[model samples]
Target: MLLLDLLLMLLIAYGFGFLYYGLYRNLSARVHGRFGPSLAQSFSDSIKLFVKEESTTFGWMFYLGPVIMASGAVLNVLFIPFLNQGESLQGLSSYGNLIVVLYLMVLGPLGNALGVGSSGNPFGVMGVTRGLTRLLALELPFYLAAIGVMIDAGSADFGIIMQAQSTQSNMFAHPLLFAAAFISFLGFMGKSPFDVVGAPQEVYSGPATEFSGKFLALLMSQSAMFSFAKLLLMVNLFWGGADHLGELVAKTFVLFVAATFIGSVYARFSTVQSVEFLIRIPTLLGIVGLALL
Candidate 1:
């Protein structure tokens, strides 16, 4: 049953991710006054990539990296809630909390960085450097928002956090943190401004440029997982966990739209500029939120 529940959550998150891939394309197209591909475009792309020829630069480690990344993403999905009190596979809520989730969230990216580094591509290495650079700044607001939630809830377990918000959402209590977090989330989503790592104009898809075939397919799927996990994290942090599946989807869609708009409205920032922006603004807000708490 636990295994089945875990699989179900993975499937659900993947479905959302698949939908998001199409949603992004369609929305981007609409903004440009051009009709876009159907919402299944992402699924189509994944299918095409799956049957393509596999290429490898590094040996055993390259093969291992995607697998590890996907595994970590799957673990992350199981740890978060979709339908409140609905189902949790690992029963890890007892030991798990914001701190654990935060650590787990980085695991997939770390694995991807390792894989990309092993491939011996200068561009991929540059992407990893940009990713880490941006991460250093972007993490502060998220950390501040998370700590505020922890303090308000008096516990780090997400379920308890949700319960605490049943009476009053954290967004009200920590508006500064929310603003900081929401802004930082833009960076986290790798949209404009903070998309330095994968900026096609500059880095040529960055770290994943060298990936092909099955490995690429796995990476794509993991991207969807990462997207879903991020939405879940945001919802849990600000609004608390959704009370129903419909509510969950609604919240996720709202976040997706917000991320897309931010991506569209802002021009891409250079790595240094992005780091500077995160540091001076969101970082300071986070510090204030923590101090206020």
Candidate 2:
């Protein structure tokens, strides 16, 4: 039963992730005054990439990186329940809590850093280093916000947190924490302004620059799934867990659209600028929220 539920969650996340990403591209294009590809374009590209033969120019580290990433993403999805008051959609959530989920969240990226370093491409190494540096700024405020949520609920369990918000969602009760978390969430989505990991002129591509064929395809596949898991986590934390599948889609879609529009309006920030802004605004908000709590 648990296996079946997990399988369903994985399929849903993979499908929805690509769909949302496609929407992001279309919306961003519209914001920039141009027509974009169809909503299925991203999914089609992932399929096409998977069908193609893989390149073997790199070592085992290069090959296993995406696997580890996918594993982390899978763990994340399984440990977060989709509905607040249901046994049907529960995965492995009963066995874990907020802190466990948080640790699993960063596991993939840190695991990938090993492979990115093994690639031995100067630009890739540089990109990974910058990405890790930016991660510190991204994580601090987000962690503080998560801590506030855990403290407010008086328990680290997602069920406890969701039940506590039965009367009022955290978004309204702790607006400052939500504000801090929302900003960090945008960075986590790798949206504009904060998305400097792929800065071509500044650092030349990124961690996946050297990968091609199967490896690159796998990375994209995992990225799509991973993105949805992040959305699920956010929705559960701030909006309160959904009552049904329709509600889940609505909440995540609203959040995705908001991030897409916001990302499109802003110019890309430099690495230094991105780090500094996260430190200044979101971190400050997180600290203040915690103090009030």
Candidate 3:
């Protein structure tokens, strides 16, 4: 029964994740005054990539990178409860807390970094370096906001946090924390002004430069899944978990649209610029939020 529930969650994440990725592309194209591809384009692209004939790898580590990444994304989806109060959608949340989920979030990226490094591509190495540098600043504000929530609820459990927000969601109760987290979340989503890690013109696709064919396909698939996991995380933490699947889709779509529009308007930041801005602004907001808490 538990295994079946886990599979269902994976299916949901995979399906919605690609759907949103397609939406993101379509929306971005519309912003640029061009007709966009179909909403299923992302799914089609993944399938096409999977069927391609050629893929390159640097031994076992390269092969394992996407697998590890996908696993981390799956684990994240499992650990985070889909509904605030329900046995049906809880998955493995009972076995973990926010801290565990937080740690698991980084596991995939780190594994991917190792795989990228092993590829012997200078561009990939440079991209990985930029990513790690950006990550240091990116994590600060979100961590602070998360810490504040945990402290306020007096527990690290997601259900406990959700319960505390029954009367008022954290978005209202802790606006400063939400602001801090939302800004950092924009970076996590690889939106404008924080998307230096994979700037094609500058880094030649960054950490993904050497990946091709099935490896690239796996990366895309995992990325789609990971995107949903991040969206779910924010929804659970701030808006309060959803009561039903429809509500979940509505809340996450709103969040996704906001990120997409913001990303479209701004230019990409340099690695140093991204780090400096994150450290100065969102980090300050987070600190103030924690103090208020």
lDDT against the true structure, per candidate, is 0.83, 0.88, 0.91
Please name the candidate that would achieve the greatest TM-score relative to the true structure.
3
lDDT of 2 by residue, 86-202 (tens): 887788889998899999988888877888888888888877887888889999999999999999999999999999888999999999999999999999888888889877777
Best by lDDT: 3
Better of 1 and 2 by TM-score: 2
Model 1 lowest lDDT segment of ten = 86-95
**Residues 175-254 of candidate 3: C-alpha lDDT, one tens digit per residue:** 99999999989998989989998999999999899999888989898888888999999999999889999999999999
After superposition, which runs of candidate 1 have C-alpha atoms over 4 Å from their true positions?
86-95
RMSD of each: 1.6, 1.2, 0.9
Residue 115 in candidate 3, Cα distance off native in Å: 0.5
Ranking by lDDT: 3, 2, 1
> Which parts of model 3 are misplaced by more than 4 Å?
none
TM-score: model 1 vs. ground truth: 0.95
